[model samples]
Target: MQQSNAYIIIFSVILTVVLGLLLSGTSEVLKPIQKKAEELDTKKQILGAVVPAEQISRMKAEEINQFYESRIASKVVNIAGEEVEEQDGVQVTAENIDVAKNYKKAPEDRLYPVFIFHEEGNEEAANAYIFPVYGSGLWDNIWGYLALQTDMATIEGITFSHAGETPGLGARITSPEVQQRYKEKSIYSESGELVSVVMQKGEGKDYSGEPHKVDGLSGATITAEGVNKMLKNYLEHYQSYMERKKEGTPKMALN
Candidate 1:
């Protein structure tokens, strides 16, 4: 009886393994379509930042793809903020390819891509800089894209998307009301120092009631502060690049 029971358990375990393998294989088969969908969704989210409300309401996936092909150029950036050397139209990828991986330290050098977007058929339109941002919110990582105009002082658009942040509080990053606060923010001092808009709690937010000073999240103080810190860190590292580009005249070069 003991031997029979052992054989039964072994067979059951083998069956389970086989079933798992079959499911995994199915998932692998579906992964390309899944990845395409995710890429499409990401584009939509980024496009949503600048797309007006009425247009966004009517935006379609096919339209986004067409616009992407015509108007967006993606280049893999190295840790040094240099465009990644490409091979056969594919950007190189390897271990430690992302500078954000070394977010805590002054990265010696790292790689992160920049997305440039422009209007289709606009012969003189300047491309904008769009970078991905990730930082801890009150409850989880708040992730989003920050897009800067050629001047870098004038923000083209920003979209904040968070996971697991409290509803009606930290989650307000996704709110258009909150996002509009980022428009026209100068990340540079007039003397060319790195600085983005600062978020302060309660009574300290509005200094002279300028539009640039956005209010802190009332109940979600931590998340608001997280936005401030993350931008400070990321933009500081990007200062050298911004300054050089500024000197080069971003709008002309973007063309």
Candidate 2:
């Protein structure tokens, strides 16, 4: 008792529609959870720029969120360093702006996010400023957060992440050992030029005396170059904001 072609066609259509609806419903159900997870991860990465990785890793997701809410405050700015309250009718926020998408636009057309880490209970007094940077790596995109000390010139801590890169070579950028090398490094020269820190040509060289250079990844020169360019580009983008803050004339208050 074989089914008719019309019956088979009708069954197929019904099956397809049902499957599609099921998938759509499942996606809708999971969307919020996925978003929460991404938000949590982003907070962890931002915190990674200032807090120790081991410390962050030790905490639970709820703890991470609580800590971020209590200590971090953010603002959005443009290339000219003016505070941006809204853009194209949408309220701008440091957490909402996507750095990777902004990287695709012309520098002057992009919005930058500044995450300020304040004292435990005092939001008015900033301890460090964190900025996100994005660039191309050998295989794919690379990005990171750089936290500058209160002076806005010296690096407090740094954290790097990649979309895709060699496991042990270029991927080393995310390693604590590599990032630790950038701590205390200055992004400015003695003459006050914003000569952002450079990842020199090779690893194991003495850059201890060089205020603006760090050891390159062992076998990842291209990735190192990517990191170098990302830092210089984003640092320049944020320079005006830093200068304004340093001179005590920031367009917006820390709170």
TM-score against truth, every candidate? 0.79, 0.90
Task: Give each model's whole-structure lDDT.
Answer: 0.70, 0.93
lDDT of 2 by residue, 1-255 (tens): 459998999999999999999999999999999999999999999999999999999999999999999999999999999999999998988999999999999999999999999988788788899999899888999999999998889999999999998999999999999999999999999899999999988789989998899999878999999999999999999999999888873533543
Instruction: Provide the RMSD of all predictions against the true structure, rounded to 1 decimal.
Output: 4.2, 3.2
**Clashes per model (N, Cα, C within 3 A):** 4, 0
Candidate 2's TM-score = 0.90
- lDDT string, candidate 1, 1-255, tens digits: 657988999989999999999999999999999988877777776676566545755867788788766776666554455656664686564222343354544454545556667778552464687766667888877777788888866677788888789998889888887877777766666676666877768533554345346667788889899888777766765666666567778457656
Question: Where is the poorest 10-residue window by lDDT in model 1?
Answer: 93-102
Candidate 2: where are CA atoms >4 Å away? Answer: 1-19, 249-255
lDDT of 1: 0.70
lDDT leader: 2
